[model samples]
Target chain A: MSTEIAIHIQDIHKEFLLSHSGSASLKTALLWWKRRQLEELKVLRGLTIEVKRGECVALVGRNGAGKSTLLSLLARVYKPTSGTITINGRIAPLLELGAGFHPDLTGQENALFNAMILGLSRKEATARIEPILAFAELEKYRDAPVRTYSSGMLARLGFSIAAHVDADILIVDEVLAVGDFAFERKCFAFIEEFKQKNGTILFVSHDREDVLQVSDRCIWLKDGQVEQEGDPLTVLDAYESGTA
Target chain B: MRSEFQELWRFRELLFAMVERELKIRYKNSVLGFVWSLLMPLATILVMWLVFKVFLRNDTPNFSAYVLAAYLPYQFIQLAVLDSAQSVLISLPVVKKVYFPREILPLASVISNFIHLLLSLPIFFIFLFVIYATYGFEVSPFTWRMLFLPVLLVITFMLTAGMAFIISALNVFYEDVKYAVSLLLYIFFFLTPVMYFSENVFYALKDKPYGMLLYNLYHANPMAMLVTAYKKTLVPMGKIDPGGGEGLIPMLPMNWPMFGVTVAITLAFFFGGYALFNRMKWRFVERP
Candidate 1:
């Protein structure tokens, strides 16, 4: 118990029932009203994994390979259809950049809102307000609605706020590809510092170099299965060769 | 159940932020800004007043005031319902990717419209005062009873928010709901006592005893009760004739019976919306 596992997942499985597009129309709605059948789309199969406190791990998978679904499960965005996750620490999930942001809201407003969504008290978030502005390099545009921002600007703003959140566990998904190279380098530096401070990090990226650079270990997922879990270099080699 | 409400409540700040954004954006690029909130109901009342007084030669007493009272409350209800219905559908990009209380989208619409309602209040009262001064009708002072308006609005809000949650969740699965809502509101307008009065329903249906049917519908419809309550409080209903007091009316006290009905039905809608929303919300992210 003292080992302090930040997250514990055992035998987790998820399945989704997707309806045909015509399910919404009144004609089909009436026809299928009684039958109520949905086409089955099995997005996630049975899987098991865990992460200890202060561990930095990378989750790698191809598109539709269930990496996003797994992250969603871990973040409790979607409850698992089966199995359970015991998460003991505060989780700040940068699940998708700008996910909670309102396009019409100013940058500063979005930051506070994003902070609150990530579970920080308004006052706590407000105290770091200046730092967030400085980090995003959007001090002049803080009052401008995010709609006015470029995708890179939006990503920068999102990354800045996500970085400032105080949490025991952080979950990041494919957002390293956002922003310019300079901003990306800055973000990687932040990730390295966070790793050094013993913050538990879970990230997913198709970029093997990124996985190798930031993660202490890597988990390679293929078709919703954990294909390999080990040092980033070896796992990437195996995943690449296997897919090849 | 407790945890559910706590989870929803804890995210109240997020709701406020979204509401603030909505209000600002709504008024920002426009020349009129907050005036548009006032103008919608004001213009509606002006048009109706002209039609009732000049064209029809209808001698209904304080017709201007009647239009103002009825129109304002109707706008509040309209704004709340329309915004709530679209909340989830519009915020799909955000809600699909992020995890927060899904109810906040519709709830935010309610708050933003409620702010617009607040902005429109001065206009409502100013018109009342103008009618009072010009026609020499004694005006009622601001009273504690006015506090009940918020209570009523809140109930209306919860009802709309819940419906918005349900409709939005449904709309996510069925895109046509977005188009259907506008048409629905068009029919809903006549159903409520917005352009016409409950008296008009009876007048139009007098030969068939249709007024009684309308009265029944009135009792069942929370918005009808609310509009009537607003009339009772704001426009003097000094007389309760069989046909909506054909002439001058005096301010009557708030109708407690209608108030009770409004409260009860609002609760019913809120719970109904909640149950439906909870049942449908899980399917939202996956639907599209």
Candidate 2:
């Protein structure tokens, strides 16, 4: 149906073992290693979901609602403890704001490293190098270390790299918030292009306006379970009305 | 194996990139740059030569050359282990980001140190020529012995890589391991026969079985064997060959058996290190 589901999620679950404090002592570490003393924080309960080809879906939830965790699972960054996720095409993930950047390395060098990490061949990475720099509009500062850039500058470079990655599915996590208003408009434009080209997107956002503006469909996640799902306007209205 | 090789092959460019980064970072903000790589070993060699040969006045043949050869490989070992051990923690920023093969960090350290060693070669040759010209020493025939150099490098690389992977991975859980490895590497420096000869152990042991145990441990050490092979490469025939005299032509071949041992031990270290790193990588994702 519709040339195979782009992403198939069947009853996924995840739980993390968190320490009592921010850091672990030798004693706590030993206990953690032995699994003799620990507290489990269950993040994602039994949840099933799917996204078809050419679909634009928004995952809306409050902080700690497992939106990031679900995206991480899809990206293969974190494995599901008990579920199967079979994704049919290449994945382009803007997992976090400029996660691959080195503080001391130039923005140009970080682009090269980030491209290679995204599964591009070295030559392919080199070919896309100019376009990425141009899109970020940091051609002048491309040779400067990323540490010199503001948060907005770093996000611009990151979003540019993600947009250039050719993939069937683009997993975005509040990437629009990284840049200023101008880049936010750019991200919405990219979303429109992506949808027109029949590319799949799994976007997570806390902004109802952004969700309603870009996503054709939306799912509201409360705690770890799906609270509601349907058209974006109806779902956003329900989520906002209920919370208010 | 093909898949593993494919994984490594894909990351080879990054490996070279990281090696370049390490070399650059090592000399960064320093006036001397990589001159430190040479000066440390050279200074130690001079000190040992002064203490053992000049002051003691009990000169073994080619004593200066013996100390230099011993110290050079030993210095390489010291650096390879220390750098490898710190590679992962040192690149925590990169490791926490988009994934490539993690082995690139340690392997990059190996390659960086190897480059440092390569830089030292011209100086080593210059030393060889100077000693020969001034001290009336003559080099042995450049036979198959020279082939052992590359082999020795591969072995040291493998051993360092393996140990580095294990230590760096462990350091993720325990911050103390950084200091612990520093102390252990210092101890290993003294234990390794870089400054002293293995023959000294044999002479010290004399007839006691305790000496035999020490001898076994000494030979079993991959680093010792590599250093010994390197010494044989640099030591002149006129000095060590019993068959040599005022007119007698000397002939001593390379130690093929020792070379084979080094190769096997190195492969063992590399495979073991790689396997351990693969097993531990997934856990490292959430670690730091």
Candidate 3:
């Protein structure tokens, strides 16, 4: 496997059926031929991009410009209707903080659960549990059910688990715009350290400062296509002007 | 489809983790944590015993033993189906955000209840041990054929997992699936022999013109076949002694040909369910 290119998405397209939306009833489900009434909505159209190893690429776009869909595609939440997505490493998708947390589970348990979901073995997750709790600053509340934790506390724990996964590519989707200022800074600091480790990153965010600070390069998406690509400041400025 | 299996295999540890979470959360807030799982079956036995022996003057003899074989597997299937119908809906937030094989949610619920099934087997054995100890060993419930217990259990699991995959996938598409599953299970409870032997059904319909055919066709119901198999294997001779000496109601021989057909049907259902789930999985988060 070539380790140089981290993610190579070529001419990918995605379509979703707008009708026959759900199998809410036996009648609808049994009427198989009637499902052809579905209206197809193409969310992503012929989008292609490649990220080199150890690059931090930020995606900036207006609402409904297909940024979220593209990140989700990279995260494998949804597959492409056609085209190829070849990736060369472990992927830790931080699409939303507390992505798989059970409110009734304690901090320690949820951390172990999240680590395993992010592709760690029980033994490995156990080994890192102590560090994850310490980093999240939830060591004192480790045994307490996470339902009792504040929203900020939940995001902190969520971010802490993703940080420990040692993933080759990280798909972060606007999760930093959460928690208190101090914790947000800590998360940013971790992202900087992650970048220093030659980790590839594809991130989506509406925060201008966060984008400029974290991304090495930037791509602007509009109407399911790449509108512009260049240095972080230039693309971010262009995206800002176009949206304005 | 093959990659989905491999992905699920790679995430097998997560399956364990999810099952653990389910069992833990189920009883976590209660004073009696794990014992509550035991109490459900115990209470059920007590209720059914009261109904059969005390109230209706219906004497089936060791009715608790009779119901035990059917109840355990029925509870496994029922619990799995009910929870699996809500599995995706409850995890909708996570599904929208993160990516996993997504089958793990339903599978974890099924397996946790399966664990409950395993745990409750001791109670059945203990109940039988006491019964046998009091009433001489001449009427032992278990036979050497009990060795087929594991095979029977796996078949039950396949039937359960197959149903779990389908309902859970359907639930993601339509929230109505949860309600329909509950309604169906309530009706299905009567159809499965949770209260009486499957033989009772066969005997009831024996006088009808199409009786023999219907009786033979009855085994085709996966639940009917499984529960009967369990009862026959675990409690070979079901003799009713309502304080008066009575003869064992000898269990009919295992219907081998019917059993073969039932297994085939269960396999087809299992594969069909897996195929349906995979086909609908990608569209789970799609909204027009």
Q: Best-fitting candidate, measured by TM-score?
A: 3
> Which of 1 and 2 is the better model by DockQ?
1
Per-prediction CA RMSD (Å): 3.0, 4.1, 2.9
Clashing pairs in 1: B236-B250, B236-B251, B237-B250, B238-B250
Q: Write the per-residue lDDT of candidate 3 for residues B1-288, one digit (tens) a residue.
A: 688889889889889989998998898878988788778887998899888778866566567777877888898899988988888878878777778888898899899999989988988898877777776776676679889999999899988999999999987766678888899898988888778777677666878999999888777788888888888788756644332233345556888888888898889878888889888887788732
Docking class of 1: acceptable
C-alpha lDDT score of every prediction, in listed order: 0.75, 0.75, 0.84
Over 4 Å off, model 2: A1-4, A21-36, A95-97, A242-244, B27-32, B56-58, B90-97, B141-143, B237-265
TM-score of each: 0.90, 0.88, 0.93
Docking class of 2: acceptable
Model 2, A80-164: lDDT tens digits are: 8798888988898873668867777888888877876777767888899899999888899998888999988898898888888
Best by lDDT: 3
Report the lDDT of model 2 for residue A167. Answer: 76
Please report how far candidate 1 places residue B42 from its true position, in Å. Answer: 1.1
Q: Which candidate number would show the highest DockQ if scored against the true structure?
A: 3
Scanning candidate 2 chain B in windows of ten residues, the lowest lDDT window is B240-249
Tens digit of lDDT per residue, candidate 3, span A1-244? 4779999999989887777445445666677876787777787889999999999999999888888888888878888999999999989887365867888888899899888888889999999999999988999999998889998888888888888988999988889876888888998888888889999989999999989999999999888899999899999888888889
